[model samples]
Target: MGGGHTGASERASARATERARSTRLNAAEKEKDERQKNSPNATKAIAEGMNVISTTSLKRKRSVMKQFRGKESIFKRPEALPPRFKNKDVPDYHKHPHKWVRYTLGDVSPEDMSDQSNTAAALSFLRELKERKELIDTNNIELEVPPETL
Candidate 1:
């Protein structure tokens, strides 16, 4: 009788484990189906510009921020489709509207010398200066130039 009871308990335990596993699998399948149904519409709307991603992203960000209080987002920045800068001739489309002044390095002041055109000059100057002073430290270097000098 004890042996029969042990056998029955083992069978019951096995049955419970199988049922739990099946339940978990079913839940996972349901979630996948829900995602599939929702994803198509989301993608279509995004493609059509009918759906702006910012709201959804903001919502997700808010939820995530709440979850971690002040943690940084884990999602990698999406690669921007190379700016359709309508005019590719306009060098940097990424700069802000207010930063229109363009300057090469050394065009204005040593500080502004790091601007795109002046980079070579700035580098050459630094290299020459470094050669003249074997123990020169870069930490003391300071730049004083307005952004518009270019």
Candidate 2:
């Protein structure tokens, strides 16, 4: 839908913009290098800053939250899943063996069992930061709203 043809002006503008961007990136790289020379950890922290929560992003999140002002938002009581697909028993690995049983399934094949397993909404790993922060754990995460809670 976009690029058809560009005249001299458009080509000159594109080259100028590309040169400006390259210049800015090279300057940033030089600054990062200068910081790295002082303490290598600075670079590590800078890198970590991208993945971890940051001030501006956090502020934006907070601003979005303010729209809800005193009301509950985003999160909702997810509807319960239908029973047909809820029939997987915990897997039982009988014994540790040299060759081993790679895996074993019950009467229902995993494919069949999982047809509507996540038909209902998959729970969000809702987390908070800043004011009352919660630890963000990705490796060990609980994605289900336990039946007892329901």
- Give the Cα lDDT of each candidate: 0.63, 0.55
Displacement of residue 83 (Cα, Å) in model 1 is: 63
The sequence of per-residue lDDT tens digits that candidate 2 reaches over residues 23-106 is 765685676567454654544557787455546545644664464466533357789986765346543444335545556566
Write down the TM-score of every candidate: 0.28, 0.25
Candidate 2: 10-residue stretch with minimal lDDT: 123-132
What is the per-residue lDDT of model 1 for residues 66-98, given as tens digits with 9 covering 90 to 100? Answer: 644543333466897887666766556355656
CA displacement after TM-score superposition, residue 63 of candidate 2 (Å):
20
Give per-residue lDDT, candidate 1, residue 135. Answer: 43
